[model samples]
Target: MDGDRRIAAEIIEAVGGKENIVSAAHCATRLRIMVKDKEQIDQSKVEHIEKVKGAFFNSGQYQVILGTGTVNKIYEEVIKLGVESSSKGEQTKEAAKSGSVFQRAIRSFGDVFVPIIPALVATGLFMGVRGLVMQEKILSLFGITPDHVPDNFILFTQVLTDTAFIFLPALVAWSTFRVFGGSPIIGLVLGLMLVSPSLPNAWEVAGGQAEVIKFFGFIPVVGYQGSVLPAFIAGIVGAKLEQQIRKRVPDTFDLIVTPFLTLLVMIFLALFIIGPIFHSVEEVMLHATVAVLEWPFGISGFIIGFLNQMIVITGVHHVFNLLEIQLLEKFGNNPYNAIVTCSVAAQGGAALAVGLKTKSKKLKALALPSSLSALLGITEPAIFGVNLRYFKPFVMGLIGGGVGGFFASIFGLKGTGMAITVIPGTLLYLNGQIVLYLLVNLIAIAVAFILTWLFGFHDKMLKNQE
Candidate 1:
């Protein structure tokens, strides 16, 4: 109790006292303070305070990472010290002030995709479990024959594994609409219209099993199944169109008129314009991604592995989502995840090394749990709360990720999924490649831990804080 107040007092003093604070709020792991002037905050002193894991300026706020439980307690102290508190919505606007335009756009892409990840991750796990249990060799080891398994059970597995992907467009569109401030339900319906049983299945049309519906002499139309870019485009257009329609329609007719015009226009654009144009573009992107990853001697993998964490720092990592989705769309498997898993695992290792080596009990507490989170495939806490706070460990992590990625490509490691990486991601490799997957992650974690322990970190780094 006393410790929280002392830390809170020091933090308030370090950031130029309560007079300079405009508003303050605490999230799960950090204290976000919007200040009147950035020059007043002491970066060094703020970081040097015990219980303060790290600090950085973001958006329009000075953010201090104080871990989870400690942050909530420290926040009470901060409020008690007479600092005004702000709502998360207001904090978001203030946060909007920090990142570059490019950074903001990239993060917007991330936001749209973030909500849809769980569905994809769950489906991937289901796919892996089915693959694991259905393998002939594995069944033999268990003294069970494939013939003994019920046929209906196989159909049930398909229901679990395929439903999410079959309706992927709806998920993508719904999320995108929400991100862009449109009615998510309308976006979902529009997306469903694109894949309506009325339209010819794209795969069947390609396989010559179904006929292509042409609107004019040149445009051929087919149902968008297992698609992404088209739905994303449709979502953006539909949302903006809906907003415009709402503005023009009078209040009396607004509710009915707005959605009717929006859907009517968007359905045509989704099928006629966005679908054909972006689908071709998606094909080109898919091919280009395959070519680069297949580049000689795994050079591309090494480069991506090394730069992945750097991209995260720039707040632009979400750009890779398209590529990942493209890989899954074309191949039914994603090799990119192999490279990403290495990158993410190395971050965990670097944080783990810091936790093991740092002498400060407070620093140790933050690093260890952050490391665990990173290992389980979430890197933000580890990166911001520990590794990046110490410069050399971050660089070492990147090196580790690069080396691991190189090996991943050399050994042809791939995953039967997207959106999940590192530990939870093991489900993707359960089919027949779990061994290789473990090896890739081991190399990543081991290299990072070794490098950071030997050269990247030391107890002296926290001696001042202690």
Candidate 2:
């Protein structure tokens, strides 16, 4: 705890002291601070702080990357030090004003999806495990034929693997409500109503085994299992509507009346209106995405790979979680994840080259740790701390990533899930594709390392760091 306080104090001082801070908030991996005077900040000092993996200015905020759990602790400590803090939604709104319309949309999508990735990652791992155990060769090696496997065990695994996607609407709506400053519980209830068992199952309807019910003989409704966009759109509407209603209701009756009315209206809008409209939009998006990914000669994969880490640097890469989830839901696997993993590996490779070639002890220290971290599927340390600073290495990493992405797509390599990548990502390829997965990563790392070592860094750059 004392350590946290010291780090927080250091961070506060480094970012031009608490007096210069306009507002502070944190997301999953960063301490985002809006400062009254950017000129007062010493970026070098902040980057060198203990436990700070990297730091950069983006969208008018100085974002100090502290990875996942550590950022939350540092944020709490900052709050304790008399610095005024904004709610996530308020901070998001403030930050959104600095970006273009497209960038803001990406940031909003990140806000919604970042909170729910853990659930999707867990479900993906569960699916991998289920796949592993159900493999015919594995079953035979264990002397347990597929026919001999327990039905109850299969059912249990199915439940584990299916729950998150099956109830995706609730998760999306709940997170979206939180992002939009609404009552998360009310958002959850509205989302639950969208996928209630009482409604016809979306999959069953698609399979032509079930029919949608007509509400009052005019409004047709169906369950929203596996849907994403509708729940997100409904969450915004619900939150805004609830806020407006709160203004009119007396404080004494506000809590009770606001929730009841919000849910009543939101649920109606979600089921009969938002669900149908966005479901079609989602279908179009899904089709478009598939078409792009399946484009000839892996051109789409190369572009996505090259630019993926750039997206990460901007903190908008979390938006891809929605696409990954949608892909997994529709096709039961994610080729996008496989392609992106190569991009991640390329970043690590470039960072490793920097680490190996740099003569300055400080540059060596930063590059090595950041490279290892990137290899483990986290890239901010490598990108923000080492590669981006060097400029050439970052570009080399992108080129390497593009090359790797091309090969991955050419091979049609895919993981069983979304989220996890690089070394740990091997778990997702456990069902007979592990070897191919490893090969793709090796190709990415090798290409990136060779490129960066040859052209990306110089001793003069390290001297500058000194």
Candidate 3:
């Protein structure tokens, strides 16, 4: 542990010294850093740090993707550094810029969720496969559908897929408490309260019903199931309250009394204050989606272009899951879903174009398949494995995404109800959305390819040997 801290501290210094860091936090396997200037931060040096797997910047955060086993220690060290620096008045104005509302929002989402990417990857793959399985006659013969399938497999998959959402507050509370230097036990207690089964009906308090004897005559705490923001708020309050309790309590009973008091207060707030506030925010976003979709095309186009990328990185990008399910819920199939499909294809196209033009044989090999994979809506390979390494490809892909999103929005292309698949979905077999989906995808690919070819690759000379 000491050695790890020593190494982390050394690397922190080597990357333009501590003064260069505006703020630092970790998400899953990556360290989300904001620095005074990208120019001063030595990306190569940072990448070379012991246990550092790779380094890159995306959407303004300098991400140091660390390997497993060391993320928690590094995250803690980084947070302590942040806290201590602030205390000493060594903090710079650049830190303020790093903590902007937009940047903070992105960072919060990433930090809270990125650490759980492996489980998510598995869940996503499983869900995607399940969708395909239900559609396959051979698999259906084994009974996989709601009516036909064995109950056990369905229950198992449900548990796996729903675990994250059902217990999200618990996870958030734990992570936030760790970051804030509070007790994990207290966090767990607070988090569990938000998702507790009892809180949902607590909203009946607002109705002034008979036998409505509330705690002190009618104030009630609402449930926070499937909520993200409320858990965060509760965690923050819990941490602060824990600190206060720790300061007041004597050292002898510190461990026992501190957590007990902290948990009690946080549960109260989670049930009463934080949960309700977050629910309101979610409602706002849900309601706004419709109004925005109804707006003028040009305005909607720009917003879609901008917000789509934002949504993808946050992993909530799968909230589109609900929309896809909406097809099954209402119409038995979804239509008008071309936007995300095309957006994903744009990235793949951009990567593929650059992959072909790059002089490096190894890079080309990576880019080619990455783009192909991304066309099916898997951008991790394209974004991280390809674009992050090759600058021109990422730029072209961003351009392609913007262009494709704009045009698709203008044409009013709609998706046919189908589970998103990589290769099978590319054909546009069922509807005009699929056809236009292919067209928009092709347009993005062509534009990205042209841009990458003209811009020139960093390793242009290397591939000539092939």
Candidate 4:
């Protein structure tokens, strides 16, 4: 058999074969398996598989890490190996993960925002290219001048870079409706209403170029272009309303009644209630995050960097997505991403130091690839499989991250976008800001690498650790 097949076969054997598997699914970085018997699993054998970076049980599922792009392939081979997929299985998997109300809520936010990141990233790259081509210094470096740039080309770049953010409410609402089990088409329509041209534009209103229309003498209303919270809340309410309406209306009228009722009720609530309320809520949140980011002399950066990876361990880091989106929506760039990147770089650095100094070949094998993975963008393999397993290296990485984040705050670094980070994250800094970005990562990585090398690991501890 080929590598995927071989890996699938081994996973099947290790997990007590297909007969014992209740169901199996794959996410971005892991193969999640629900088994009939946990005790039957030889987890050590699963971990030793060639591409699996780590293995663990969580949320009542056995999660095997195979990194992004590989998990799906391995999952396919596993399915072909007689562990069939079932709707019940998929349902059970989702149901199993619906932990507390807070967890489900946070996970919902993650699911909604994760789909939207690629668009933002593409937009950020377009902005980077635009900034690069129009820069006097960069153009002079290429023996070209700014006057050589065409007016139409700059306009074209604006379209590429601005469309996603301008219509962000539509995207967020569409995603929220999908998550909340509403008609996504209705969600899209509702989102569009929030940004309708008939209403005063949000940016114009902010800049005092337009005024909010007061309906019923007290309700202040303006377009919700580029808004986050309003759209998100609208999606949830609209979806829930649609579901409730569908149940009450006859099937004959359901198609017309459900959507009509959802839109009619949602449009009013969204414009007058949600828009007015949550927009202010979002502003409050924005101000609070600003306070933290601007906290005296980089103190906030140091604290966030030190504690961020520790937050990752608890798996609630998705909450930051809302804050980041708010920051970008208000400020046009994200300073939070810069500080977070330093923390991530530190993790990779600590893992690299451990890989270099460890005597055991297994330690060397696991540490090196996981370190590379952390540097590229994903850090679970590095955290769970290597650094956290060693303990001290994780602490050293945290300290390094803190130190780097302090510098990031001092430098006032901001990224063009979110999602991509560390090495691939260079795209976010390409708008005449790459140098400072590089310096932050270098400082974080160097600090973590040096600290871990000097005091973090020992070969003797390997005998006691998993």
Candidate 5:
């Protein structure tokens, strides 16, 4: 397998050539590629390639699973092609190539970031849980106290969970430039433009608190740190520029001239023009969300809660994560985002109820652990293994989610930077008018359990599978 580069190349060629590859990136177990035309891609040929373990398509992406250690090398080779292919044939080879780089960088960053989710989630939940434990004096047995809460380990975990967001643009730029066929040094410069200290203050200027700042009394650009669209859009433009410059420059000058020109142009474009325009739009949107959430709590909570489950199912849940992070960083807290907790709880409760009601021992076994994991806010097992298998449980979970979400909305309950935890921890936001969030979560759990138990557990469909 180490000697076999042809397998990957053959698959790429079969898919329609380097040009057909609109973008290419890899995850831990899969190579995620987007191509210009589905019809031109030979699925059979891709599957038949040696060491190609599997092939499938989801969400417009062509996924090819390969053996270990092969994908990274293969991805590097693909990025080297420096050509873009598009469905309309409207985009340039550089643009097409850059598009792949941009998309794949997102995917690759996701690959790196996703593996840490469980630990990050666990740490986040533990923060809430730890607070609860201290509140209840539950840690007396371990000689723990309120002061003990801020230990080095806890501080370390806090940094770890936050590291992704704080350094996100750097990570994105590093991955993006690599995927787009540019030098990492250029990516570092691009990354700097986003995370620069000067930019955040520029937002204050944009909002009318201050005036623009100049570098060497000439350059002027707004801030874009922690902004997703700006650095990403800049990177796309930068990669294209790199491709164009690399092609025209003599081989001797290519090494020094190409990256220098790419970085110079990208920084100017990002700082002086595109970055500010895009960043301003996001700031406006943020203001809009802030104003909207100030409305009747019920409406905001209901919609957010309802859409949360749907978005996660579609694997666009990261968008929510991004939003939540942004809101917390800029505005202190987000009031309308209570569904993640309830949905996780509902999923678990529904699965547990099904487990209890099921006559099939196998289903009971499956549901038991899934429900427990779901309780811990890990719902993939529950969603895929049990709820998705038996339709009613999933529907019940959604219904419970919607109803609970509605109540949470009514209460105006919002989480204050606590990591997601079990069902009960999410109820921490309930106080007076917000108490409904707690009550509704319990009701949602009960409803999910009872309804799934009644209609789902003993269903003949699941029994037959067992």
Candidate 6:
């Protein structure tokens, strides 16, 4: 406990003391802090702090990398020290107001999907496990024929794997509602209605197995299974509508009337208006993404891979969630995940070079763990803490990422799931493509490491530190 307090004190002092801080929050592994004065931050001092892995200014926040579990502890201690804590939604809203149009759109997409990624990631892992267990080689090793597998076991896995994607709209809507300050339960119910059993399944309609329902003899509607945009749009409308209704409804009956009217009006709008229009828009976006990936000579892959980490730096990488989800829904696989993994690996590689070349023990300590963390598929530590601090290393990483993405595109490598990458990404390729995936990552890491080692860092900084 004393150690925690001390570390917390160091963080507070490094970020320019308590008065400079507006709000602080924590994600899976970062302590995201929004401070009033960015210039007051001591980047070098923060990075050298004990228990601090890396730190960077992203979007509108000064994000400190404290790694998983440790971040939560430090977050609590910081709060105890009189630094006000803000909800993630509030932080996002503050950050969202300042970016360019495209950037703001990307940030909005991130806001909607960030809260829902845990469910998707859990589902993806479950799918990977199911794939591994169902593989012929695994079955043979277990001396079990395909027909001999237990029926209940298969059913259980199916239930676990399919629940998230099957009802993804509800998850999106629930999250969007919360982000927009609406009642999450109402948002969830509205989302559930979009994919209700009463409506024909979306895939069935897509496959021509079931017909779309014609409402009032003209309105065409179908279940929104695996749809993201519609739920996102509907959530916004529902939240706004709920807010408006609450303003008019008397306090005595506010609870019942607010929910009833919000759902009643929003569901109709979702079914008749938002669903069909955005569904078409989603299709166009999906098709456009496919076209970009299919561009000749791997140009598309090179571009995407090179710019991937740049997007992460701006804190807009979560926008890719929509594209990946749509890709998996339409194609049953996501190549984007494969391509982006290269970018992540390259960042790790660059960080590794920095770790090895730097003479300063403090810089070495920061670089190594950040590199390892990036290799594990989370690159914030490596990016914010090491590579970006030394500008050359980051550019070297982009070059390596581009080269790796080009090769992956040429070879057409893809993963079986979305959301997991780098080391844990191996789970997605367990159905016989693991070697190809590993080779791609190796090439990416090697290229970035060599380029960074040769040209990325200057010894002058190390000399100064010494």
Q: Best TM-score goes to which candidate?
A: 4
Against the hidden reference, what TM-scores do the models get? 0.90, 0.89, 0.59, 0.93, 0.62, 0.91
In model 6, the clashing pairs are: none
Candidate 6 per-residue C-alpha lDDT over 171-215 given as tens digits, one digit per residue, 9 for 90 to 100: 999988987779999999999999999999999998999999999
Q: Per-residue lDDT for 1-466 in model 3, tens only? A: 5867865785677567777876676554566666667787776566446656456665555676554446667766766654222321122123323555866554444444444444434444454455545454646677554466778878887776556656766777876676555787778777887767665532233344323324555564565545566776777778888999999999999979998888777776666666656657755654565466546664564456435644765534544543343332222232334555555666677777767766756566667766766766667657766565555566676666667666767776544333353344543223323456567667666776677677735564334422
What TM-score does candidate 3 get on C-alpha atoms?
0.59
Q: Compose the digit string of candidate 5's lDDT tens values, residues 2-54.
A: 43556666877878887787777665545667777878888767755655544
Of models 4 and 6, which has the larger TM-score? 4
- Which segments of candidate 4 are over 4 A away from where they belong? 1-10, 13-20, 36-45, 48-50, 68-73, 86-93, 141-149
Ranking the candidates on lDDT from highest down gives 2, 6, 4, 1, 5, 3
Global lDDT of each candidate? 0.86, 0.88, 0.59, 0.87, 0.63, 0.87
Better of 2 and 6 by TM-score: 6
Clashing residue pairs found in predicted model 5: 23-100, 84-93, 84-96, 84-97, 199-223, 297-409, 298-409
Candidate 2 per-residue lDDT over residues 1-466, each given as its tens digit: 5999999999999988989999889987889998888899998888778888789888768889887788899999999999999976677678778868888777777888877888888888887887787889999998998899999998898899889988999999998888788989988988888889999999999899999899889877899999999999999999899999999999999979999999989888898888889989999999998999999998988999999988887677776787888999998899999989999999999999999998867678778888888889988889998889888999999998898899889889878898889998988988888888888888889988998999888888755775
Clash number for every model?
1, 0, 6, 0, 7, 0
Count of clashes in candidate 3: 6
Clashes of 5: 7
RMSD (CA, Å), candidate 5 to true, equals 9.7
Model 5 residue 322 CA deviation (Å) reads 3.2
Measured by TM-score, how close is model 6 to the native structure? 0.91
Candidate 5 wrong stretches, greater than 4 Å: 1-168, 178-185, 197-210, 214-220, 291-297, 334-337, 416-441, 463-466
